[model samples]
Target chain A: MRNQHQNGTNHQVRHYQALSPAQINRFGLVELGSSGPLYRFCVRLFGILALLGIVGFMMRVASSGFSDRAAWGYYVATVVFIFVTFQAAPTVAFAIRAAKGHWRRPVSRIAELFAVVGVLNLILLLPVLFLIPPITGGRKTFWFELHWLLPFSAPGFFLFFGMLALVVCGLCLLYLSALPDFAAARDAKGGIYTGLARGWVGSQRQWKMLKSGLNLLGAFYLMTFVLVTTLFAWDVSETLVPGWKDAIYPAFHSITGLQGAIASTILALGIARKFGGLKNHLHMEQFWGLSKPLLATSLLWFYMGWSTFLTYWYGRTLAEQHVLQLLMFGPYFTVFVMSFLLKFLIPLLFLIWNRVRMSIMGPVLIALSILTGDIFEMVRLYVGPFTITEVGHEMTHVPAAHLPDFADILIIAGAISGAIFIYLVSSKIIPRISLWDMKEGMLLTRVQSFHRAEVLVIGKPE
Target chain B: MVDKSILGLFKDPDSTADAVDSLRKAGFGNHTFDILSGVPYPEGTFGEHGPGHKLFVFPLIGAICGFSVALLLTLGTQVSFPMVQGGKPLIAIPPMMVIMYEGTMLGAILFTVLGVLFESRLPRPGVGLYDTRITEGFIGLLVSCPEEKIGAAEQALRGAGAEDIKTESASGGGR
Candidate 1:
């Protein structure tokens, strides 16, 4: 292991030894750990909080007779938590693979690790299931009462199964992508690693198969993720409130999720660098690569969101106007502004500068802003729709007045804590970095002096 | 017949690649020697013909299966139940597209993984020629030679700057 030697006055300046593929494997042999007391305390704290949140959620369900408003806060939190935490994570890995981005090797596994949260998201959907009333009450959902297709018609059924399929696909992708790492682990410590790394020989045939498998699976997972997000936007949010139809809303939601995924990935990489003892692996180039997408998605969010707002504002359609009022100018007005400022304005202003985009702290801070904005955005999108009482397929009045109760706070807090808990636990099980991918990268990448500073040159075959 | 396999460790990719070319020119067949290194160098790096890999078939087959499954679910449900939703058509093309897309992708991904596993034969025992040091940085060239030619193979490897060489006579493993 290369240790940082403090030379002269600058403590932050640390030198890294150029490691060959074999040397990289030696580092990979050690288990992934941040190994900080503070990290453990925070994880345990979050775990306890998550437990409390789950208990509180169940208690709230028992007390409040399964009404939409009764569970509205929980619903909003669920959407935000899932999207911000892991639902969009697969996109990070997928996008990198699709682009053949060389810098992705260090952080792709970090993004893939978020897929485990899909399981947690599925369990969290239970509250959603209970809160949804039967479609017979004139509730306008995607489901229809056709006796022959009854099993497939329910919103709950589609959502549950869709999530399940997503989770299973994620697991398969994670397993296939990390087979070589498992083989490495097995060779180092032969117990369960033997089963996990089964038949991985790293032969020419195996390499080809592995590449094809990862590519196809990655492409598939990306599609499923987008579809599932669209499903959520259409069936759950848009259709729930009568006359709340916005074609771009679903696409907007997806872009927001991708933005959040990128942000969360940056945060994870920072943690891994600072505490997890992977300074050599995580570099400025990785941050530089991700910042571009983050900026692009953030800009798209503004464009799409403005387009939706403008269409309604100019059309003067009462139904669309009402939704706009409810989300933009009504009780959640402040939140909408905060969402725009944090997610769009702040990120755009700061990230526009090349220096800020390249720096480690710049993007991380911007990501934090985007995440905060996402929570507010979720509140504006879902809470308004849930509270609206539709009669005769028309809203009696937009239920704009909003106040979060104690159970509401508990459920939302719990969901967030639960997401954190799952991610923390998952970090221990899987290698935080994809050792195989990193090795391939180290093999291909060479450093050459450009101008005054050293530049890493990545080679691709002709 | 007893067969002797010699494993040579080289300090850098260039020397290891040179030794591979030298051995191949000396009439060692493609299957006679194998190169192992921590990094994945391209197949042609050592002047060897790349192995043919037909892995795309996996995803292609998966795509077909996924499309079929989507058709079954979307069209099947529509045909079976035939309920008029909000006066809309029973077979909604728009909504079904979403389901179809997901299914197609699911099929392609899962089958691609299956293809990889089938081709790679993963979870199988590690090869005896493999050395943990290969992953650290050393490039290893393992070659099986006849008893009479073992001396020539070692000299060729040594001339190519092999840092360390080990030979073992094992009874019945070829290719």
Candidate 2:
């Protein structure tokens, strides 16, 4: 034990060796540049595969476009995905850290940005819809063929741009507002994407550009975040039979999208931490902060589910009743049940416990389960819309027809992959950890005597 | 003339900072003297010199501008669009609050990072003399005394428990 000289009080003076700034090691961020060739090949391979897959999918959609044979699968799958996105896996937690105090760093910032980026899918839907009119030979496709979707065909000032602008604006704003972050990245070295971020000076003039870009984008998020849900809801309903109406559609769509966004971000982070090899810097603390949002988003979604279901239970009308009955007892029933139990119940019961959340593997498993459950929910909702097959003596309605073909899965995969690839690839080029914050931590930091000055940590409020 | 210059033995930082506070009562020249500590010891702890520059002020100003810009973007620009949404007002204050909050915080944090970086022209590297041991938790004393009394100053530092007293030739002073 070291000797301590004492004052009149019970305290003793202890000599401490101080750190010199000259001692600070200039640590270079580990470049993920090595993985570039492999990642690029994967991306290019996906593009070729997507192109080849598109042909078969186009032929199927073209064949199925006008046939009276009902196509309920899209609605069913989307519903399930939506349910999980909102209800089950709203955010993913990182492993091996205190889940409570994770929000103080950069992880949550990215998760929030992921939620914002999720709007891209909404914008992508428009071109798909616009293409639908031409693809179906000017006749009513699944959406227009149905009576429920006729409202979309009705006159409204913003039938097209209203939907498009919201998402376009939101994405533009989010991406643009990230200019400072881009400048941060630009300052860093290595990787394929680093040079692209080069001209971003964090100068006042450049900030003016950011301000303008964000203003345009912020206005977009305000309108599009809500309306994107409306568009998706309308599109889904239009695919169903003549009169399937569910007021809970938008709520379902919004929450599910949110859930998927969170799950996507979490799973992506998990994978990126491994593949991108950012484990040392990204840390468990960040993962835990991200998980809090995941937990919260799911809770909000469960409530939304009850709201959607309670209405169906109360509405005793024939069409609504039949749709509800079909969902509860018909082919969609099993998936519906599975989604309910797995997405809401399992995560709710398990995640709320502190011990489960602290474990790294637990959250990844939960996110995966929620993802499967989401797909189940999507199948339940979309497949039912197609289950409008007239009850017949000879034919049994084959439910597999409603399932997503390999093409749908691939394109959707590609769409999501492209967005995430941008993030993963960009990180290598720039420093992921805030250098300024680190320096600030060093410069402005004050360490006080704690427990006899044994712990030299940043000063905290007593 | 035979003499012993009682200096230059071990490279030890004179951390007798506790004694510096008592110098006023001991009748030393009260002309604003500063104590340079090895670690970032607080000002009151050893009567050390505060940070050389008031760099934190720029970040605060930047934060205010950020807050103002966010509000201007939300409330100011919404006026330009003026397209009513779901019967919501043209200048929706509630939504503006979210933008303002995020923007203000972002501005504050970013400005803080930039302020620190600018204040210390770090990462723009050109090496000079430094004791690596100082970085490895060794305290270092950096001080200035009257040019004429440097000999007396050297003696005073040795008497005050300084080790390995040596002068560093100041060169390439660019930050």
Candidate 3:
């Protein structure tokens, strides 16, 4: 009825209200200083838990230096940190943008903010560096010992530079994507926003540049992410364990990282919707849209995991048998089941239900389940390889089951809590939603009547 | 004599489209005016979309650069200090290929983004000819006319269904 003003040519004068910058500024971001009692409580709780975990990590490091048990605990914590924070969180942004999915707008910023966590990972990697045994005789690592020609390719230098580049690239991409919003914010609040909004005049040229920058940076980040994860898997997991050789394991590890990233993105979205006051901006549509990818990744997780198992299963050699015992049937058997079932089986079953896939709660729950499974999966992957104290071409004995000690528990708690704390802090600096992208979506979308139902039509740029 | 700039707001896209047509008929060239709206109506909805097919070339150039870098990293490093393993050749193709492919893609993507920014001249700080209402579902048509044709421009816009009109000096102050 509001659009009933027909022109002489019979075109309807649609009365759509565009949100002003003021309106957008009000709802586009959650106030960094303001919070509900629940949010305050959660932050405080996570903070205390994170401190305890950090204290526990210090104790573990002080008490057990290069000892097998200490190494196991460190490896456990490292895997958890990589999966939860660094690898998965930033990935959702790149994956969605590269695919050209319009629904990516809301959650992309949330994903990009995890770029800072890469710094935390670089710091956490220090202990792992100290523990890498001297590469002598039969221990062939992916890295060549050309310490003179390629000094940076050394494990420590390589990870540091790689992670540094990743963080820088991520920040650049984030800045470029949000340049318009920064300009909008700048016009309103001319302090820090002015500096950040440099060169954004909204000229036709700038818009083209922003679009191109996002696409290119996003592609570069995705490829780099896979390569980085592969390097981590190869150096830390495969090379450290004697007589362990699996070509597909590194690739499998990277795929799992992607699944974890999708899960982390979903979880973050659910939380923001509930508490960060993003309910209107983040809709069920985003959840449903993202669920399809989650499902595909879940299937891929199983396929990769099975491929590793099948290779070992079919070979049935003594060395291959030892790998099975260490990773699957030996001390890690329970964890293997959890990773296989929770990560793969249950997720596969629950996601198969259309009702579950369509709702926000269903995917969030599935994401949590998968995250839990990821923890177990990391433990299985790391603990097995770490407990092997001997280095030989032929593994005469499979490592026995090694349970997590108190240190492992503390470190794990600390790592996870630390991830939450970092995410919360980053949310303050980077808006939870890509405000400019949201505005773009608002401009492009219109409700049209379709026989019996009103369908939303999104205009695509030519 | 200074030129005059006139901006008119239309309540609907049809009226705005009509005004664009009228302004063109009045001898205001396509490049002399701009249409701003909250929605990106299809290109040519107003007239021709802004220039360039140069964006497509960025990825090709990037891929070539990336491939070159990968070749140098993989081959150059091995040649300088050969770390032969398991009787494999000094130049391993499979592992090198992966690095090369990733590098190529990275180059293509980065360059593509740069090309867009270069073409757009983005991050340009300062305002231009714009209206806040343009983002609020109002289609605004901005035009530059000679001092003598100011009346004719006003008449054309009003006849084409402009809801509101404003005229400003064709100086930097208009933005």
Candidate 4:
């Protein structure tokens, strides 16, 4: 004997009932937190700060009149700056992954904002193109600038614009690929974010359009970043060391850039998680997941740095050997020690400790350490030669100049900060997270009897 | 540290046989405590605790060798063929020192990596009492007890939320 209930007990509830109830969308899931007033405020603050900094830099440059530091300082800063072009791809990869990772849920929006701004800042790099004129202007500084290739007309303009086009193209594609996310942000609220998201709507047609375009653009950007960054590294950085040239320099720059990107994202996430009330949906599980990349890359960065040195030591070239010497004990020893401690030692120790890596403090500390080492890497490349003090001086060698003054650092700091400011503001209007992705995750989740007698979530493919 | 005896809470079936042994000795092996984690931490050599690790020294050796080599190649080589430039000596050692500095750091970090791999017992084909479920987030505890204590141990395991008690035995790597 079977018992049937009016509401279909132990069966489908109200089969073929009137379809009058408001349809609850299980698929459309977006993060609950809104940037609110803080989003707009931060954007405005960053723009104000950046403009102020640029103005200050102009004032300093006017007062100083090319009296910043020695030739070595200029050379090193230029080398590191140029090498950054190669790093762009890896940096983008890092930013994307960090933003997408689950642990980054708390402050993922801010990270996306941070990355977009970083991409835009590449435009500000237009001024760096100015460096070419002085070198290629047929003017000699201690030695006539090497014109191994172009002996007739100045090719500086051509080289600069050609590289600029490639970078701009790559950046444009990357930005376009992020459009769907921006659309999601735009629809989030009626204020700033919605304004940025402007035309993006969550429709099948729109998604298809975004996915196809993004896939095509992502591949182009990836390839372009690889090619252009390598070219930039070779032409700009390696030559600064006189005889110090390595096949790995291009790869090294790229990998370091990736490391930098990873670190930057981690730092941004840390800042967001704390300042923004993000701990609710963003759980501890997410933090560990994001950490795995940082750990893996830190090791890779470690490997890249080591292999370059190992090969140089073995090859024993006059130029290579001297370049190594200038870094080790000659003039850059203190900086070397600092880099070692920050880059390898501290990170290794922290990563090995499971407790530390799992903790909130780990990401912050490691990011700071990497930043310090990054600065040191630049100094070693350019500063060591100039800063070396001749100990047993019997007229055998000349003492190079000291490290770069506060003025040079200030310039870079200001420029980078300005770039960061732009990112902060843009994010207020942009949907930093991919709404389509969030909705997809929602669709794949279901409540089920996970075991014999317990309820748990079963993840299904969308 | 949590005692291996409480492994019941962590849920190991083989420990049941051991619990019987403990029961015969008039002991329930209540020294057992549960591991707070999402994966099982297996136990080995019932009477003897596994060896504790010391990785601190590995990086030290690496750092020493690294700095030492960095000094020799850059500074030492400069003495050998110091390229004299702009009225400088034949062995212009300072510029070469830059290479040494980067080299030293590189060497130390490489050694540190080698040291970490060595200390962690990593890349094991098959390692101590493990269940794939642990990776998917299950905290297993390995209990040690005498045979006679089996019933109480099983009850205790269930009371502490043992998903299931499994007989965990180590199989050699090749197996």
| Winning model by DockQ | 1
Worst 10 residues of 1 chain A by lDDT: A6-15
User: What local lDDT score does residue A335 receive in model 2, on the 0 to 100 scale?
Assistant: 79
DockQ measured for candidate 4: 0.01
Residues A273-357, candidate 3: write the lDDT tens digits. 8888877567676788878888998898888878888988999988888878888898778888988887888889999999998
Per-model TM against the reference: 0.88, 0.54, 0.83, 0.55
Off by over 4 Å in 4: A1-52, A63-112, A118-120, A132-201, A315-318, A382-401, A452-462, B1-175
Each candidate's DockQ: 0.44, 0.04, 0.28, 0.01
The candidate scoring highest on lDDT is 1
Deviation of model 1 at A339, angstroms? 1.4
lDDT of 2 by residue, B74-102 (tens): 56555654545435566767545645555
Candidate 2 CA-lDDT value: 0.45
Model 4 chain B worst lDDT run, 10 consecutive residues = B33-42
TM-score order of candidates, best first? 1, 3, 4, 2
lDDT of 3: 0.69
Winner on DockQ (3 vs 4): 3
For residues B1-175, could you state the per-residue lDDT of candidate 3 as single tens digits?
6677777888776887788778778887767676654443545665634644477688689889988997898788779878785556889786677567666766776677667666765445544555545544466777776878878778888999999887774434334
Tens digits of per-residue lDDT, candidate 1, A1-462, equal 342443332211233345656555657666363346866987989988888887777777677756645356545556555765466787799789778888788889888888888877888876575444456556666654433444333665666656766787788888877777776776666677767877454555566666767777777777777677777777666777777768898898778788888988887788778877777788777888899999999999999999989988988777777777888987779989999899999999999999999888888888888878888888877777777657335554677556777777777777788887888786665677888888887677665555555555677852
